[model samples]
Target: MDIPLPTIAVVGLGTMGTGIAEVLARAGREVIGIDISDAAARRAARALEASTARAVGRGRISAAERRAVLARFRTFSDLRAAADAGLVIEVVPESYETKLGVLRALDGIVAPSAVLATGTNALSVTRLAAESARPERVLGLHFFHPAPVMRLVEVVSSVLTSDRAVAAVTALARELGKEPVAVGDRPGFVADGLLFGYLNQAAAMYECGYASREDIDAAMRLGCGLPMGPLALLDLIGVDTARTVLDAMHAASHDRLHAPSPVLRQLVDAGLTGRKAGRGFYTYEAPGSAVPVPDALTPSPAAGAVPGRQVASVGVVGSGTMASGIAEVFAVAGYGVVLTARSPEKAAAARERIAASLARSVDRGRISAGARDATLARIVPAGSADALAEVDLAVEAVAEDLEVKRRLFATLDKVCRPGAVLATTTSSLPVVACARATSRPADVVGMHFFNPAPAMKLVEVVRTVLTCDEAHATVREVAATVRKHPVDCGDRAGFIVNALLFPYLNNAVKMVGEHYATPDDIDAAMKLGGGYPMGPFELLDVVGLDVSLAIERALHREFRDPGLAPAPLLEHLVAAGCLGRKTGRGFREYGRR
Candidate 1:
């Protein structure tokens, strides 16, 4: 039997409320849209009609369908009109007192069984439920912005909420074509819990001068494939709104990470709220405009003090995937690449891998067929370190074992020219360790590249204490030559990306272990709410649980921070042989398991 759609009432018809009302009405529900004043109600009605007309223009709905959808909506400035609604979703401003007052009013007017839901992104649902006489009928129906477009909805249930109330809301969300995930009543719930921490960290990164806003955003976008960089997304979300969300999460969790960065508060105080205010991290032509223009706050890239040395040729070590990819990156940039492996067969295999990767790039229109063939031609297969004797730079992409890297560096230091730059592509291990192995520590540096080096655009140019200015400048130039954004940082365990990224992933695991949220729900929250390309669990599965555990442990050991410690669940999964994609099992199951 088909479940009948409920008569929905959306109160406080602002942007979010109006969108919810539109979504409910389009889903064939009789929607009562309410506001505090006649002008507010009229504005909401006009917004809804304009949005529906846009749908008609886009062929998303016919003119007849638009009219039919509009017919389902009834606007009112009085609360009594919604007394008969089966479900009431309050989209009032995110003020606890204001929401509580509205809930109390609804409690007096609505039917005894009517479900009262709040469209809160932050704020305690449990606390909100306390304001209602019928707490069992109160739940949270937290929707992302532009409710009609975003597919995810967090259905939060307080301890006092009845299961039937939660189920009804979940079913209603499904009826509206949304992916609803059940969550326990917690401040920020699942999405903002995982999201705001990352955003705050990004803000801290900018404030501390770790990297420019553009570079930080570019790194995530081009490296991790996120929909938008943190700063740009912050601007779109409104700096003031972000500050409010962060403050709420901090008050609830007492986690220092959720505290809004001082810069964020300052920007909000300056009335640079975001796109809605025409200025934030970036400037806009007018309030509510999407187009961003360069602002006075734009950060300038650090100018390298030493001049970069010329490099006509580069040599890469190892036969691994990273090695092949690195060789391809250098080759595609028109550098003569000498790729070496332990044996002739291994070197031949690496060449084939590089050729295949370039061919795929051509197939995807990333490069032309001519460029692919030309890139492959520049990569020469070699079986010995002696092949790097004349190269200007040699980067080793061998296994993570320190001794292995140490031994390789020693050999390269002897074979390569006196001034040739030596780099190690270690993501977690210390760059200084590799430098110590080389006779000329001044010439050695770390050039950490993300996986699939040919595709990723960010390169961490690490400078050790012993590294000279010239060596750092040369590597930075080489990174730019290969079309990668170079961010300078000291030689540290996990560096920037791994240090920041692993802890966030581990927190998601901890949240699952604590049963605060399910893996699927957490993943959906991060992806849909946070605009991440992959949820933490999904990323862990791809990166392998064992690898994530290893990185987290390294970070913990280096920082001596409990928060960086590997989650017990991660260790248990790895110990159980559930090492993610490799073992076909981790946070989630894969393959034929």
Candidate 2:
């Protein structure tokens, strides 16, 4: 038995509501759009015409098809227009009182069996359902912003919600070409539950001046491959709205992670809500404009920057993939490269790996054969640290162990010349500790490059208290010479990227452990709703579970927050030897390489 919800009424025709109405009409369902303001109702109608016309111009729909879609959608200023709708979805504001009033009013308008849904991402769906006349038919149907584009629709079921009501809407969501994830009654459900906490951390980090807003945003975008930076995304999703969501989340869980940052409240009180108000984390060209204009908070390119020490030659130590990648990057940038390893054979093998990578680039037409030959010729592989004596800069790319790095820095201290800038590529160790191993503590710094260095453009230029201006500036300059975007941060546990990233990963593991959602549903929710390049579980599998758990431990040790502790599920998996793709099992199974 199937219930076809062919006629849908979308209440409150704002951006999200209008997008929903357009999607329903395009899917061959009659859509009645209701908004209190005549202007908003008219604006939605105009936006649909422009959208459908663009679709016709782009060959997405024929002229006849566009006309029919337009005809299927009708706008009204009263709730009476929804009397014939089989389902009514209210996309009003996020306030509890505001949403409850709409659902109560819709109770008498639609048929007794007609389903009523609240589109609040933060408020309690169960509470809203309890206040409605037909509690069994009321639920939550939350669509992401720009509803026509994003494919995710969270079909939220409260305790009182009827199974038949859920089934009918789930089927309708599929017919509308959306992936509907069934979620329990909770603030944020799956996607926003994870998303908002990460955003709140980014806000708190900026508020504390850990990094510039631009640098914080850029680190996530380049380092983690996120579509937008946190601050910019906060501006897009109104600051006031974010605060409301966090408040609801904190009220339920009382986790400090869900507590809204003080900066959000400040921004809201100042009326700098977001792009809708033309200002927030960053300033836009105008109210409701997408373009960001320069503001007082924007960094000046030349402000207080110290000049860097010059380096014509570089020493890259170790024979791992990162070592070879670093050597290739320096060589490609026309710097003389001395690549060293534990043995002559290992050093030569590392160079051969570089040769193969460059050969692939040449075959793909990315670089000239002559350029590849030149890059290979510039790298001189050697068997010992003695070869690094005269190089202007020395970079260590060994395993992520503190003692191994300290011993290497002690070696670099004696072997290399006094003025040479000594550096370590340690992702999580203290740069200050590495510097202390050397007599010239001022010389050591951290230059963290993401995996497959030449392809990833971001480099974190780490500065410790012991690191002098010259050493810090030299790495920033060298990073630019090799065409990498450099972001600055103090010497700490995870730097910028890992600090915000690992905590979110830990929470996702907690979610799966709690049996609230499956990895597949949560992954789909984040990918389609939040625009992540890869889901957390997918990334955890790629980056070994062992590696992820180790980082999680490091962060928890440094922060000492209960929430930052590694999820017991992650630790148990590591204990069981299910250490991800390399082991052919992790959060998910994969073919062993």
Number of the top lDDT candidate: 2
Total clashes, candidate 2? 0
Instruction: Flag regions of model 2 displaced more than 4 Å.
Output: none
State the lDDT of candidate 2 residue by residue for 97-152, as single tens digits.
89999999999899998999999999999999998999999999999988999999
For candidate 1, lDDT tens digit of each residue in 1-593? Answer: 22234688999988899889989989999999999878878988898899999999999999999998989999998889898898999999888999999999998898888889998888888988986799998999999888888988999999899988888888888888999999988777888777777778788878887667777777677767888888888998889888989999888767777779999999988999989999888788899998987677665555766787788999999999999999989998899999999988899999999888877888889899999888888988999999999999999999988999999999998899989999999999999999998889999999989898887888988888899988999999999999998877778787777766887898798899998988888888888766788899999999988888889888888878655678899999999999988887788787864
TM accuracy, model 2: 0.98
Off by over 4 Å in 1: 1-6, 37-39, 300-306, 359-373, 465-469
* Backbone Cα, N, C clashes tallied per candidate: 0, 0
Top of the candidates by TM-score: 2
Residue 531 local lDDT, model 2: 94
